[model samples]
Target: MRVLGVDPGLTRCGVGVVEGTPGRPCTLVAVGVIRTDPDAPLPDRLLRLDTKLTEYIARFAPDAVAVERVFSQHNVASVIGTAQASGVAILAGARADVAVHTYTPSEVKAAITGSGTADKKQMTSMVTRLLRLEVAPKPADAADALALAICHVWRGGTQARIAAARTRVEEKGTRT
Candidate 1:
């Protein structure tokens, strides 16, 4: 399955695209960031975010968009900016008819590193090691994006398998 993972930020929104199921290697379709100058006005940044995100969704044509749920509560400004960026990414996914799901930081960490309280360094290291990536996904935000995709693929695969098995059981029972 095609998957697009997004790490939304005001100035640099990270995105990663991969195609595959869990335990299997997923081909990296594309991975990059949408950069907006922090000096620019908020509206301009949002516009830039919209344009870049739309382009990404169109280019990758992912089945789903996995994004990190906003967690930090210290800086209201930071939170607001991230929310806007995330909103634009979601809009792009909706436009492309892609299912969008938001996962908490803990969920992502647990999925990627088998720990809900994983530190940034641990998460980064785990992502690099698990993906067999030559270099760590850079700019922290980008790594987070890749992590999101990996998390979704892992969770989605499990869910799908369980669903298929349940369906099979139902069918067999109906026949009996």
Candidate 2:
């Protein structure tokens, strides 16, 4: 099963691709951040995000795209931009015929670290250990993306879980 995890922001968006079997750890296919100038016009930033996200969807060909839900800590502007960025990711996935799913920060943290109130460092550390990565996913955005991926993996989406089942079926046939 393959999933594209997205951490959306107006200035910097993070993306990750992960694949795994049912009983094994997820393998990181790719992980990185997409950045735009915060100084740029909002429309321009949105366009840039759209372009980059479409490219990512094309390159990764993910079965599903998992994005973080919008929850404002304090800044209204930041929340608005996050919603826009998330829209871009959803549109990108829609264009590619891939389904999009949204997970809350607490949900992601709980799935990855077994705690809803897990800190960034704790989430990062758990993501690293779960994926067997040598270094933590960086820039916080990327860690969040990886965490989103892990959430979807742990919760089992339709596409991802279905793909995993197919692989198991084929493996069983081969064994027989």
Best by lDDT: 1
Q: Which residue pairs come into collision in candidate 1?
A: none
lDDT of 1 by residue, 29-115 (tens): 778888999999988989888888888888878889998887666367689889888888888888778899898989999998889
Give the per-residue lDDT of model 2 (tens digit) for 29-80.
9999999998889899999988988988888888789998887673785788
Query: Per-prediction TM-score, please?
Result: 0.90, 0.86
Q: RMSD to the native, candidate 1? A: 1.8
The candidate that achieves the highest TM-score relative to the unseen native structure: 1
| RMSD after CA superposition, every candidate | 1.8, 5.4
**Each model's C-alpha lDDT?**
0.87, 0.86
Q: Where is the poorest 10-residue window by lDDT in model 2?
A: 153-162
TM-score, predicted candidate 2 vs. hidden true structure: 0.86
